[model samples]
Target chain A: MLPLSVPFIATAVLSVLGYVVARKRALSVAGGDIRTLTSLPHQHGLNTALSTLLPPLAVMMVWAIGARIAARSDVALVPENPTMVYIILIGLAVTGFVLSLLRISTSFRARTASEGWIMGLLIFASTIAVLTTVGIVLSMVSETLNFFGQYDFRDFFFSTTWSPNFRGDSDLGIIPLIWGTLYISFIALVFAVPVGLFAAVYLSEYAGPRLRSVAKPLIEILAGIPTIVYGLFALVTVGPLLRDYFAEPMGLGQSASSVMTAGLVMGIMLIPFVSSLSDDIINAVPQAMRDGSLGLGATKSETIRKVVVPAALPGIVGAVLLAASRAIGETMIVVLGAGAAARLSLNPFEAMTTVTVKIVSQLTGDTDFGSPETLVAFALGLTLFVITLGLNVMALFIVRRYREQYE
Target chain B: MTDYKISAKGVQVYYGDNHAIKDVDVQIEDKTVTAFIGPSGCGKSTFLRTLNRMNDTIDICRVEGDIRIDGEDIYDPAVDPVQLRAKVGMVFQKPNPFPKSIYDNVAYGPKIHGLARNKSDLDEIVEKSLRKAALWNEAKDRLDAPGTGLSGGQQQRLCIARAIATAPEVLLMDEPCSALDPIATAQVEELIDELRQSYSVVIVTHSMQQAARVSQKTAFFHLGNLVEYGETDKIFTNPEDPRTESYISGRIG
Candidate 1:
């Protein structure tokens, strides 16, 4: 078949040609009195261009997807002759161009017609966004179902041990990974929530204009640093530092890569997520509220703690929950700082592995697609998806309820 | 009790080099309704804020000279603004009730001041303040409802109740009736008249008629200067200054 660029270039050239031809046709039909036409010349041109590209692009996309599906089947890779598909695609483009060229008339409202097509394009773009999420969930669910078919659902979910082996009958219990995900996320939140909240309160309330302007973006710069960089910081710096100074000396595990190390680094990474959003929420509690409290004999700190903070509590809870969801989905920092040991231990300083790390490990490298090990990644992914989805919904509900309180 | 509840001597207020309130003097008397009448931007509100040190909140605002309330200098470094504010209560134009129960809104000041040693005492203070604000009968049944749930007039009265819960020696109302309807304005005027018996009530009003109706003594301020200060009857009938007469007759603002 012709390369993808061939059809793209052909469509672009044809669209430009269609624009010029249709504009000239419209002007001529208007008898050089542009006001006589129902729609302007530019509208006629845009309508022709949209019509010119639509047919060929749609045909090419459909043919590409059909060929991909056909190639996946137990048949030859050519999939019903790629040459015929290219010819038909080009044929449709030419037919669309010729039809549009004949349709540009003086009385026609090309503006309204083209606007309808643009609106359709916008709706289609939004549909693609929603369909992508649906597609991801479907793919994961199918694989997870296959995984449960091969392995007992109870053992996969409820069993405490997680031992994946090349020998087929691996103890694929998700409990250990689930525990590690929660434990690390808990520690991350415990470290993050208070520090982030205090920073938000101080910045939004106490910091003067000049100080706030300088400090706010500087704190947000921490968020701009990618999580992968945080992983490296965790790996090379924080892990060894914690092991030598805190963990090993306190009779905890001697491993450089432990749950404590990963949790602390991840917590630092999540500070901006909490503080920026909480700052906005705190700032939204009206200036009148602060004045009322202060006018009633309450000091600045008392006003903030008793009045402003209480008014902003619902939004702060929502922000904390969103941060919690992010902490659960975090992968890079855990893989580097938390060692790959799926042990069910009470100690936080011991090496542990999370669901995300195991999902990456099981999916990477050469492995049979039919094996339960590879399919378990989908199960882990679906569980994580469900958890984060639950958290997001709760946050949205709380924020919505908070809005109605003031409005 | 002293004849003058609050006295300002050559008070000058500057907001970042812009002289908002020029050097002026006025004496507000005890157990009387004193009204500051002026056009917009005439520094009536700024001068009222100086009494309670509310001007301290604005970083650019600077108050010079001395303002004595009940024989004590409020701006002295030793005086805590919080304690002074409790002694001198303020009600704003907009009804800003805390997003809490009506009872809690009134009890807020008393609780912070440790005025009530027990829950029943706090409850008594809230009731008495609401009663003084003429909101007791209406709000007594639903004291647990959010203060913000009240109507605009009721909310303004709730704020007044909240302000008086601390049992202040002086109460300052900055255009308290400006946002109310005609009926609500009448009700608040009557409340202000009653408030004069217990606390020295200082009100800043834009309406000349309101000053004539509610004030015992009226101070007409023009362009940051006290144009005329006398009994409300004489100020309305025959003002001393031309600017005061023009402002009263609706000539120049």
Candidate 2:
């Protein structure tokens, strides 16, 4: 609630002042003899600045979080006193500044102190990112536990039907949503992997420089177009086209908003992901491998198929797995193209809904926060996160293994 | 009247706008070890590549005039380079074994060309080729091991075995012993001496001593031209060309 800019600006000015004071003090203490000091003047300056800034920043973050937690608790240990907190934080900063200024002598190893603080800052940055991810997972897990408390865990996981009722007797089975997600993702991969891989081979192996420069960018343009635009395209164009020409005429279900529509649109969206990654991997396979095969009386096609492709296969598989992970977490395209019907059907032409779509629907309106219906969204999110996380880990392992073999 | 296994007439090679090999004519004899020695950028490698049509893989490279093998025009429109390559096998300076097992690397050419009717036949060919390259004892037990896992010399010998497995009439080696240790080089040199009894072997070497030791015929190339071509002893002992004398005596490359 305290305007954060004021303290931030003050801290920055204090750091600059601290640096100038430390550098001048070190110089005077050394009697301008640079060789006699244990560390350089700049090291002293950096050490002073880090000491002046870091402690106050840490206290400010901790105090804010402590205030929030105390407000939530039955006993408010940290009283609602932002002004007092600000005063204490500034006092701590002033103390750090005085102590570090006093410590800047010729014999003191200020370089290590400065470097240690820099390392601490870097570690803090990385920990913030890691802790944010952990925090998200923890939040999702707690909400999901709450959901299971209200809804039977067995029915939520096992039952085939997903009929969520706001009247508290809901059949919130995850099976139907999972099936839709996997089936759509399967269809998309079946359409994408071969087409995308072949496009990669062609671009990497056959295309001339002129053609590749134009074509590669054009393929990447598909990646640059937002998923929302792709969703709209799916809703407007591909869904109806499939329903009329192929699905309905063949006596399949006549719904325009079918899994087939969403799957195909998603596949088109993922082509660049598969192709570009595979292209880089295939190109990375050394030209020496190809030359060796060709030198042994193998034709161009034979060399590529038996040698280059096999060598690049592991990296290509890794790219496909990463693309598969991306396809699983995809949401907007499913929302618009596949209708909002959480049904357990095998027919690609029939309308189906994924877990992400259900999550969005469950959380939209004036919903009770404690109700099982809204809580189910967290469970769905946690499930999706775990599934994608496993796929990503596997992909990374395969790519690292492949690189080790060649390198 | 013609005992030559290969012949070239007015062979000129161009890379894009630059003429790489200029007006070269050479007749390579059958069942003899011939050596081409030159400094770097001398087009000795380029002229050797023309014999097997390996230069065709380069987009900018162009070759003119006739190159014939066994008195047959290899550059004829009717000839397929794939089949031509089966007749003429090549080994590169760096040992580039395919990323397959040792057995598979040797079996690649024979399998593609249908040289074997069964697995045993293929295995026999692999064994015989390995033995011929003097690599049988070291690599016999680990034929299933990846070809790239072998030492530099063993890998080069494996490549030689791979080339010989197809039973090519001619072998082209572009500095085969350059990447090997002296011991491996001696082993390969001995193998090359034995190979001269069967296939027409043409080697391009930077080492003058290696050229003298292995070859019966030697060709010295300078710039983009063949400066001298004669018996190895004559090229070394009494050179008609001053450039050849200067090259052999380490005066100028």
What is the C-alpha interface RMSD of model 1?
A: 1.3
Task: Assess each model's interface with DockQ, reporting 2 decimals per model.
Answer: 0.63, 0.59
**Native-to-model Cα distance after best TM-score fit, residue A81 in candidate 1, in Å:** 7.0
Candidate 2 residues A297-382, lDDT tens each?
78988988998888898899898999999889888999889888988887999999898899999999989999998999999999
- lDDT string, candidate 1, B209-247, tens digits: 999999999999988998889999999999889888998
Q: For model 2, which pairs clash? A: none
List clash counts for every candidate, in order.
0, 0
* Over 4 Å off, model 1: A1-9, A20-39, A51-107
> Model 2, retained fraction of real contacts?
0.56
Give one digit per residue, the lDDT tens place, for model 1 in A233-325. Answer: 999999999989998899897889989989999999889999999999999998888888888888999899889988898999999999999
Off by over 4 Å in 2: A1-6, A16-48, A58-88, A95-117
TM-scores vs. true structure, each candidate = 0.92, 0.91
Against the reference, the lDDT scores of all candidates come to: 0.89, 0.89
- TM-score for the first chain in candidate 1 comes to 0.91
